[model samples]
Target: MKNKYLTLLFGLLLAASSCNDWLNVDSKTILTDEDISQYPELLETQFLSSYDDLRGCIQAIGDGAFSYRQHHLSSFTDDAANNTPWDAGVMSINISPGRVFASIFSQSKGEILTPVWPYKEINKVNKFILQNKDSENSEVQSLVGEAYFIRAYMYFEMVKRYGGVPLYSGSLDHINSINDRATEEASWDYICNCLDSAIVLLPETQKVATEDRDRANRYTALALKSRAMLYAGTIAKYGKVINNGLQGVRADAARDYLIKAADAASQIIQENKYSLSSEFGDLFNGKDEDNNEIIFRFSNVAKTGRQVFHDYWNMPYRVKKAGYTAFMSPVLDIVEQFEKLDGTIQPLDYSAKFSDPADFFAGRDKRLDATIIYPGGEFMGERYSIYRETRVKTASGTKVYAYSNQEDWTNADKVPGHESYMMSGYDGIFPNTSGGGFTNYGFYLKKTLYAVKQLEDYLSAENEQDAVIIRYGEVILNYAEAAIELATSYGETKYLAEAQTAFDQLRDIHGGLPSKTMTIDVVRHERRIDLLYEGFRYWDLKRWRIGTEMHNKQFDALHPILNIDETQSPTAIYYTIERVSAPDYLITRTKWFQERDYYCPVPTDQSPGITQNDGWN
Candidate 1:
């Protein structure tokens, strides 16, 4: 998968002469400027080239890179959980390593710019559209809309990663050598307006072509707008309290944007085409392409398909894949956040006595069971055996059945192997038993593992699962969160009930249990569990801007850290005990040093003249 994308990036870099050179070498009648003018298909091909970047959209922004580390850094600034160097490892004190996140710091030059190929490709298509405006293909309008959406999306990613990024809406020429940086406000306005403009021209519905599934539609474009506006509104309004580094948007403007976002999302929901997946598990199981929850997805099919690199990042070490398993191991703090099955926050107060898995779910949210895998349960139609193996002795020595990895297990190096000496606290054991002691986090992911076979062939891009980007559930939560925050801020208690109503709709999808009072805290906690690994928690903390205190004090205080040796596979050695509470490290208040963490430092290398966002350097 990485190789394919590198090839695409290579093509984007050599796009000018590669095609012409290949055709010339073949002695074929190469389509020149005049030839392409006669054959309109040439223009269409040029326009279609933009889709390559879109097809790699998962790589472009969907990876856990942003959602987990970059965004979660905000949480570190906020008081959500502890921010260890191990989290992003290299960027511990905000001094990022050169090779790792070259673009993150100004040190590495242009290495960290948001994947530039897509923008360049989109620019090419937009230029093509403008140039061939006279061509009466009739299909060109939709293409223009798609181009708009793609460009808007590209810019949106750039804005999120780096607050005040250089905005390039049109084709860049050789003469346009100066690197321009737009104000954070201007960038947000441009992004939102661009998406709206794209939405204006797009079709309300299209013939569900396989190709078109990836292309921007009216709802998809609108969804992008909703997401952008929601972030913009929140940052602009909350930046003062959350992160002073942010240039907050006007509250009224933010509110207006939120309403627009809600309306756009409501249009998708009211239109009745998409809905919640009947089974929660089916959503990630890879068979539910028809699952209404997936409003917009980067569609991947067999062989040449999208490899969910994000999933690989946090996968459990017991389920091994790749040559290593460093990425995707769930942070210890995140593991404790899941509610019991009955809908109560997994108590972090360690003094509590309950240790049984089933008892853990008592009075907790049902969504917890839906999102995370508990100790012993049926996941993906297979019974998971989580009990620790015990050796029974009779006379001489005891015979024990311990979990052993097959010699060919790919993630062996990520473990405590004799050859590689790093202590990877994978599964249940901490690597480097004598030195580093224990790993900061304890849990691995079980959410998206299709099967053991799938784990073995992990690197194969054949995993065609459609990850849900925007779902009705999220929309409901978004509406509820915004309404609650706005209502609270505006001193109007009326919207609180509306927020509760939104919460009820989400609960109704699972099973209309009962009504619960809603608060920003309640909604935020619910979002953490509901959206567990769908990749939102870090960003949520960032926008709220309290990650540091959250990271430093919260989970460590709550969850008990047991010292386990790197003697064997975690799946085989330790008993999958019931959930337990941690100590008292959690900070109830949202107050913390959030401003510095709100926006990521623009990779110092991209624009050397621009100062690093305050407090980061």
Candidate 2:
């Protein structure tokens, strides 16, 4: 196996180095550079390999602060609570003030906290672009366009995390000659320019194969531009420039960037190439891959062994065969963000008692059902029973009892009189129980979890749900946001009508709720709900300059308590909701997001003469 791999690597190196040189060899493993170059189709084999690194940007599981790793971005924000007690880095370690202050942002060494890994991936993309940009073959030109999109996407990811990262236009020849960090404005400009080039060279769609739908097209580049420019525009409008523009954009440039974002999104909408999926849940349940809403997705086909473990880590406890489940528990703070069917925003009435706990979530936006699993919610054909405790009516008053484990319900010493009665639900939120398969926040994330029963084994990683990178729903929201920002922030009302139309389409068509007046706040709320668990919440808060307000506070969760009526014939049950801090132990301290956190601290020691973002030093 070692010799076979070595020969394959040697053949690839020779083919890439010298396309004309031929070596006469009889071994089937030895294919000379001249032999492989004869087939233009074989070039695709090399071009497709670049996506391995690009896919890392959206990988569901890994170790990193940048992408959706074990600590998903949603956990770091107010959107969700992470239940992994063994790994408290997301709450206790990663968000610490000392950790951020002492962070080493070298482009080469240190932990995976910084966006250093993307640069290594970018080098491969740059080399591909330099070699294939001028190819006469149209197929190869489209591949080159994809290369540009990959580079732009990586830079956008970097700039959002650490403003004004070092931009490499081509492959680096030496490790010592790294360029100085570009200004934040210049970095965004470079990203937009790359997308523009991609738009010009890419075809509207790949007609060769059905699987090519996952590949980048003209609309895919535009979708990214629309999203990226909105981030730049928000930073310019809300954040302040510092360190001679290395950290923030100019305030005056906000309107232009927003207009560019609106224009790019408008083109995608007007082209009529995509539409919202009829069923919102079908988009992520692996039931509808042909859905037109997905502009670009990371395809995870089970037959090919390129799959994800979303179901293994996120399915409800009753359905899971192993321990790793409910890794991301949706906090009540975000669950209430989903509006009612009538479009009214009402906070859940925790003070009110109810006959059924699921009634607390009644008449809410349909997307809530698709996105989260609450008490009495059905997932994978199993109804969830998420009560935390039981309250029994006694001669004196109501007696309260809590079960520590699943077996305590049947143990006489644990509950005594409740031995005949089920003390807690099978999926109960028990206290003092740490780790996965337990719901710390009394809810489980249903979005992105594959719904197939055959893939329910938590020990297996063979779940086949493609990660949607860029979808039309996000584009609609982006268009609405940029247009509304233009009208409200700059007094430019010409785009207001179109913005309202786009906003209403998303709400009425996908959310199944009425649309409200278009305001920056309304658009933001809709974006949060529509794009929840898609890994956009953290950056959205930072770019909107609301991280300090949203963080540095304890997020709340719902505790469902079942009230038993023994006097009734069949013993009726009622529920009461109590609000408490989510994962009180793991989230020991309030999550803090300082102003300096808007842009990560870059290391000046490794790169000489490079200016650090203000407040880091």
Candidate 3:
């Protein structure tokens, strides 16, 4: 097996180094200098490969699966649906190093961990550009432009993950000099400049083939730049917390960049080439192509499956075909944030299990049902219930991990409590081993998973549900957000005009919703519901400096979870009830006080010599 693996890897290297009479390259091949003369095709292929880099890093950093192994630190923060560890549950999250700070730091480290890979890729393409400078192929310039765009994209992510990182533009070699990390401000400026240069060189949408949707185009590059700048600008503009008891960035500078960011994003949205997906659910379906709305995404196919995300979120408690038992549960905080279908904040009592779907959940935003499975919700086109047969392991060596597949109506009294079924049936708690792996109680994610096996191919990595990097809707939202910030910075009412234009664009794409007045609160809310679970919530909250608004509270809820011991044995675990109703634990006002923690302290492990952000102690 080892020999076979080596042979396959060697073949990949050779294919990368040399073109054959067939003019075909293996998918696994790494690019090399020799492939430079091939021009646009080879460079384009390398450009697409950068996306694979994105996929690997993001799933590891952002996706919620395998607990700490796959970072879901945002879940620990208020952005997610907290389900378990009832006693100190949500409050415990405040200091849970593994889930919150550690995960954030790990994501930051991911930026630095494999810098060599992207650096090598950039070098391969750079070689092509250097060798073929005189070539008449107009495609050459575009391809070169794309290569720069790819490098900028990676660096942008790195800077966001870590405040600043080492910048590399040219090919590195044995004799090449290594550079130290740049200051955060300098790194961001360089990234923006690189993107600007690439934009000038890149082809407009008309130049690329349909099959090459994954490659960066001018619009995509601009969209990316808009996003990057928006993030940087917000942090700099609204920055309040002091580092070493010093202010971070001037508000004026922040506003300047924000206006630029808004302008860039507006350019894309104004292009009119992209729009929102017709149905919110369509965005997650793998079978969908790059509709007008999608600016950037992955092309997963059967041969190249990417089902890991769905597998982590669906339930083994219900799906007979699902080999894995555990489902990535939603944190309660996320659930609370969902507005009712009527566009009003859902009443707290409306979350009750027996609440009528028509009255409690009715008139709610369609997105709520589209994303989460609430009590008495329809899943796979059928009425679904969490009360089903379950097995439990007891300490006395009795494993009673079996229960009736019906709602426990026998406990008529408990039904009204709403606590018994809070978890949607599984052992409603975290570290709960209900279905299989470690799970947080409460509801599991079901939207991304397939119901019938027919949709299975599309649900996995093998399916081609493009992992959207940018789109028209996102651009619209950016305009709205940046407009608000710019408005605030300039003390101008026209900011409202900018914000209103963005809102109308989004609603028009969605067949036009009722018009409403503009406010920063409204714009922020729209951005949240518009782009949930795409891993934007955490960062979105951070940029707004609202992390403390979320983190300063404890979330405790009752739910069922599995109990497992060493050796992965299922022992009898008792089903206990818990809830957190304490006002101090549930309310978060700390963000109102110091604000700087919103940026998150850089991981202590990265450099102890560098002080953790002020007030961390």
Q: Rank the models by lDDT, top first.
A: 2, 3, 1
Candidate 1 positional error at 297, Å:
1.0
| C-alpha lDDT of all candidate models, in order | 0.49, 0.73, 0.51
Q: lDDT, candidate 3, residue 617?
A: 52
List model 3 lDDT by residue over 1-617, tens digit each. 54554454455457654222211222232544455453335445445454555454343224222122323444544544322223232224344332233222132333232122234444544454555445566777777677667667766655564555456554344313323546566667777887887788877773646744567788888888888888889878666424432225455568767877887887776676666776665666443555777776655554344434443434434453343343345544565566653445653452343323223345555666666665446666654443322233334552333233223322222322122432234322223322343234344554444443444433344433445556677787888888877776577555567558668656544423445555678778777766765667767776777666764455543232222222234322222222333122221212121354454344443233544444455
Which runs of model 2 end up more than 4 angstroms from their true locations?
A: 1-10, 14-37, 58-69, 86-91, 98-117, 175-179, 301-305, 351-354, 405-420, 456-461, 567-571, 603-609
lDDT of 1 by residue, 1-617 (tens): 54554454445445443222111111212234564445444444545556555544332223323222322222232213222223233333332221212232122225333422223444455565455444455466676777788778767766665576666654444312224566676788888888887787778765456544456778888777767877777776666521233334555666766666666665665676666654665565565655667666654446234444434433344444332332332344554555544455455434443324333334555554555444333455543223222233334554443223323122544323223221221233322111121122333345554542444554456556554556667776776776676676756454456557657767656533455677878778767666666656556665665554443233321122222234334422222232333222222212233445555555443234654555667
Provide the clashing-pair count of each candidate structure. Answer: 47, 1, 52
TM-score of 2: 0.89
Candidate 3 lDDT (Cα, 0 to 1): 0.51
Ten residues in sequence with the least summed lDDT for candidate 1: 20-29
* Root-mean-square deviation of every model: 8.9, 5.2, 10.2
Cα deviation at 448, candidate 3, in Å, is 3.5
